[model samples]
Target: MGRGYRRVHLEPAGAQHICANRPGARPSFGQTGVESSAMSRIRLAASLVGLLLGAACVPPPGDALEERIAEDPTLLRIVDRGELRVGIPTEALGIGADPATPGREASLTTDVAGWIADALGVEPSFRFGTTAEILESIHGGDLDLAFPLMPMTEGAVRSTKRSYTAPYYVAHQRLLLAPDTTGIDDVGKVCLFGDARTQVPVENISPGLEGIRSNDGQGCARMAASGVVDAISAPDLLLYELEASLPGSRLLEPSYNTEGYGAVVQYGETGLAGFVDAVIARAIDDGRWNEAFEARIASLTELAAEPPDLTAEEAGALFPRGLPLE
Candidate 1:
């Protein structure tokens, strides 16, 4: 696959020069009318003006901002101009949302962006759009990269020139519920977060069923909070984020299933894909990935002390027969 990356553009810093010269003073003209005191005032004003100009002309702190941007591989192009632009979804399944929280709109894509920023040693800058919009922006050369929790469908992978990195997180539809909900452990009604009448059976729920609905993760979490639905189904990590957002909400003891999550680069950007993968690999190897996961999971665990009610069979069924990652 192929993709393109763009540099961020920064506006020039604004500056003002303070001139001390009087409105119509002329140093060359004979001081016939001007008194000595007046001449002293003009000289003082001129000196002050020169001092101000010199101070203003001094470059700002060795161009620290630009220097920091330059040190980051992912932000070199952006920092050179002083801004970083990354694409994210306006709303997505459980991966991205227009979050109520400042700076973060509940989504996996945000987490991925944070990781990318850490790798680049710069703060992440997020640009929100729909999944199609984000992908289109990247493909159209308007965005350097995208971080939507896009599923790796064959058609999706083939249709875009964008390259993908190795899976960073596994995401699969999972059931979420009120901490006190009971008697509905079959995972059928538990998975459906929308209309109660359209509830589908667990076996009947396919990957297609996991499409992005109007009630996104936050909306679903809000619904759970408002007692609209007893449960919801979404990516495990996203469910965790939502649980954190919605009080009294919790993930069912066992997850519904698992899906893979990867980074999105502009079409044909093989080199950037490799670069991103290397950064992710390093994060995984350096224990940063586990640290981030455990921190989020720990918060979720503390919210409720009851252990998930998954039976051995249920746990096994959620993953491959004997997958250790399960």
Candidate 2:
């Protein structure tokens, strides 16, 4: 095991680590001086203080185990089942599911799931769910894949009992300042949306200041437009949508914090995640991903009366018959 992975127990700064379990234990080391104890304590302190920040350097437990799991039956069960069960976001207008008005069979996430199912030569069965419900499905093993990318936070990955693929998309928080304002550094108060989800990130940008909470960006936009608040910490997309409403407000460049979006699979299921990533990578390389964005998302703003249909031509470009894996 790497030194970082060694288990640590908290002890006093100067107290002798009188370990009876040490393989190198000797009578002189403990009796004459505390050299062993001093060394032990130093390692412990470094581990403890570095626990949070240092953890990123430590590799995940699944890395090595995943290589061996290919021989494990659990890894091969998906192919045997003949069905790919997925949980999808039914309400995200452009990216997730199509709006009820058009009755189209596809959206970005759903179509992607369908594409995977088709590639696997299995029937695709979908369950509609909210974010919380979908996460629960992943944790409980009720889903093979969950649509609508989950953020790759520690809590998100651990709680869902799953690992994420490389980021397929990244949405971030941005600060919008009134046009009259000189600079972001000089701004004092910031209006924010959502209490639990956005509170920490808002605090991160403006340390030592508490922001007023609103239900959504529209609420914050009103405050910022009227000059009731100096700035708003909101999504760049939302700011763009509200641009006409707040004519004089200027959106700052480079989003402050990002919400990395990746697909969620059952814990230790790196093989499946890898396959999905390969499909996505091909989509990006061949222009399918960009096509999906334009056909679904970009069309949403035009206020179209009906939804557009999706084509498998782009997705099929990756794997028309089945995966290359035997």
Candidate 3:
């Protein structure tokens, strides 16, 4: 169950080249210097032209760009121009999922992405693919960030050129039990399912656990509905969604080992990383992130009960983290 989740930090090497030529000194590129005053003037003019062109092509200052994005951001530059693209696994255990509607996967990630976009003052554009595919895309310069609920591992850090932000949320593995399993009081013996060889108890919760045998969150939810497995052990938020979808299924009282989720950016993008970090910190401070979480959970709860329409405030509040323009 490598699942492309690993803890690795990619640090940038800084300021390697410096010019030694001082003002009023003759320009030299080795032992031989510009031979004639005429040649020197021509070279200076060429250098000025190159400098002007380079300056024109450089990206705007962070604050200026942020303001522009706030005015009217769209997905075009973020997606098509490759300025800021995000990658996530097509389906991962409590982390990523393909929703029937666009931008409606697991609520936590959706809210997180929304906050990040607001912080960047840009619209977010997502690329969904398998874990391997997403990692490949990142390496090939197709993605600027990745948010796959990946576990911190050495290999992941090295492969994706990622620098992870602080943990935003934590989840624990749990067992999803069958409706018929009456006497199953012990949390461990909830009759977990996957392939028999890959299926292991909650004690063995690791990325490798998926290698032994693993079913996705949706698959486990379906299994619980069909009574194939006594219960499924996974992240609580995912379990909550599953239980909401299936009336009879219930999450066990005690959860297993807790794992953390963090935001990751491509290596060398310190500016972008700082912006993301600031936005997440603001989200925590302003209570927007919690609002979004509660709202989504409320919606799920309401849907389980009678599918009532949610207010705009309730839906918007579900994403408290707004983009910071200053």
Candidate 4:
């Protein structure tokens, strides 16, 4: 056992009772001396127990066991089952499922999951879920991995049981403006569509601008159309989808707030995470990731015509070392 760490063994219920033979026993008038002596011994034993408990060592935190579980069962289970169960986002555009393509089973998230599965020598089985549902399903053991290019923002979903691999892509938050509008200066207020990732950067970029929130992107676009809000803010890819929906809307130049997107796994899944990180790094280095992006992702949106800007220095700094931001 490691220093300051000890395993505590618990006795089974009814194995032994400390006071089994002394149920409600007390000093009787006829046997005061005997009862008092017994009581004194009991008090002394209790004091000893208190000392033992006070000096007892608590086991290390759960993360200390991560190395021990480095050979995690998650990857083995997937291999044994012959299917890698992955969770994909349902709301994110270009990456998630699309309505226009019926039974069209391929998107960025799926493609990436497929690549990971290919390495595992199994097929990828996808489950489409919203952000909250994805995190919940991952914790519930219903998903082996979640690949939505989920933004690792401070406001994003978090769990102690969850961990993220190095990011495969990085983007900056941007504003979508009306065709006639010049830039942020021409816009008084912006719609965030109730997403914290967008709201944080938008607010930080222009603290004076009034921020508006709505139920969804469509609702925010409606408000912008009516001149209720001057602009909408989102990631470049998502802003493109919004721009397509609202004709004459253009992406404002010079984006704000850098964010990296990565795959999510259950905590202590070091083996799976290591494999995923290696795969992503290899793909990005070999140009395969860019080709896939252009074919599957950029082809969908006009604004995302170019792949994300991921320099070697940026990749080394953002991923394989630590998360980009808190």
* Model 4 agreement with the true structure over 1-326: per-residue lDDT tens digits: 01111121211111111123432121112221233344443443333233222323111233122222224455545544556777776665656653334633456666667656544445566676676677677787778888654565432323356777766566667888855566678888888853463335455777677777776778778887888888988766556557767777777667776666777788667678777776565455445566667755664455443334443234334323323332
Candidate 1 to native Cα RMSD, angstroms: 16.9
**Which lDDT values do the candidates have, in the order given?**
0.46, 0.50, 0.45, 0.56
Task: For residues 1-326, write the lDDT of model 1, one tens digit per residue.
Answer: 12223222211111011112421111221222243444443443343234323433232233232233223343344322222357766543334545444534444455545555433323455666667677777777776667655444333344447766556565455666654565345222333433222223444553323322434566666655665556676556456666666666666555444444566777676555655665455445545455544433455543222212222223323333222220
Score every model by TM-score.
Answer: 0.53, 0.53, 0.55, 0.65
Per-residue accuracy of model 2 over 29-99 as CA lDDT, tens digit each:
12211223444434332332233123232212332322322343433354345456776664445545423
- The C-alpha local distance difference test score for the whole of candidate 3 amounts to 0.45
lDDT of 3 at 77: 33
Q: List the residue pairs that clash in candidate 2.
A: none
Model 4 score (lDDT): 0.56
Query: Model 1 has how many clashing residue pairs?
Result: 18
lDDT of 3 by residue, 198-280 (tens): 12355464332222124556666666566655567655545665666677655565555444455566555545555565555
**Which regions in candidate 2 have their CA more than 4 angstroms from the true location?**
1-76, 90-92, 98-106, 148-150, 158-160, 176-190, 194-210, 215-232, 235-253, 299-326
How do the candidates rank by lDDT, highest first?
A: 4, 2, 1, 3
Q: Order the candidates by TM-score, highest first.
A: 4, 3, 1, 2
